[model samples]
Target: MSQLATRPPLILTLRMDSQSQEFFNAFRKTYFPPERNYLDAHLTLFHHLNDNDQTLATVKSIAQPAFTLKTTGMKFLGAGVAFAIESKELHNIRKELAIQLHEQLIPQDKQGYRPHITIQNKVSPEAAKQLLNELQSTFQPITITARGLDLWQYLGGPWKHHAYHALGPAPG
Candidate 1:
């Protein structure tokens, strides 16, 4: 069998700037259940994409420059919380990629995209609600930079690094 055919599915995530990554990752580590935290803080673009040449080519063809996305507020996930992101440029980039790799997208990826970085998950509802209320009390909007897209090979509980498709230089 071909390597691509036997390989695990790919997950695409927005690559945040170092500062932003650290900030979010800190929150993730402090709040997310250690037993269930298999990955760092991330904003997923696609939950699952086929691991194949076509999917790789489509990601490589994206020519957008690094851009800033605003963190509008917090999203209550019943059992967790995430910071909501807002960016027209990010949306457009995903739309273009979606068109190009429509055939490789799973049903979840085919749905509308609501960009977010999950900081905490897999906790009880009460714990989640208390954290949500605490965080929301002093929440202020912040802008974060998106530098690229990272592809990962899902390994059941953890992910293996696959590749990174860097975006062009940020516009001044």
Candidate 2:
């Protein structure tokens, strides 16, 4: 196999700006101090596309204009913590994009469609519940706009500082 063939293809994602960044930073410090080096703020679209070139082309063709995303609630996934979006439109957009990418360019697993931005990973179940309780007590809704989509790669480290490339604007 060729070099390109050996590597997994990933879809682009959009990143959060300064204010959101600051909020996440503070949240991390308060609730997840151990998760250091986490840098870029983003939401993932697709990963491991079978054909990257085709996928990119297809993505560009269907991408929508940028829009706002409001953070409405919080949840925990095993040891992971994340904030949820208030807008159903945002959720639907993500799901639809994922579906489009999977159906057209590559096949995706059915169970991979949960919409969330992970804050931390690898915690005990009890700790996760405690963290959730703490978050619920201190929770405040944050609204943010989605400017674009980005393509990220796994650089073999903690998720906080993963290297990423912006693909393009999202389709409306």
The estimated TM-scores of all candidates read 0.96, 0.74
Q: lDDT of each prediction vs. the true structure?
A: 0.92, 0.60
For residue 114, give model 1's deviation from the true position in Å. Answer: 0.7
Question: How many pairs of residues collide in each model?
Answer: 0, 14
**Candidate 2, position 97, lDDT:** 61
* Tens digits of per-residue lDDT for model 2, 16-120: 666777777676656553655354435655544444565555555544555667776778878767776655655665677666665644445345455556665
Which digits, one per residue and each the tens of the lDDT, describe model 1 over residues 1-172? 9877888999999998999999999999999999998899999999888888888888999989999999999999989999999999999999998999888788999998999999989889999999999999999988999999999999887999899999999988
Give the root-mean-square deviation of each candidate in angstroms: 1.0, 4.1
Report residue 6 deviation for candidate 1 (angstroms).
Answer: 1.7
Top model number, TM-score = 1
lDDT of 1 at 118: 91
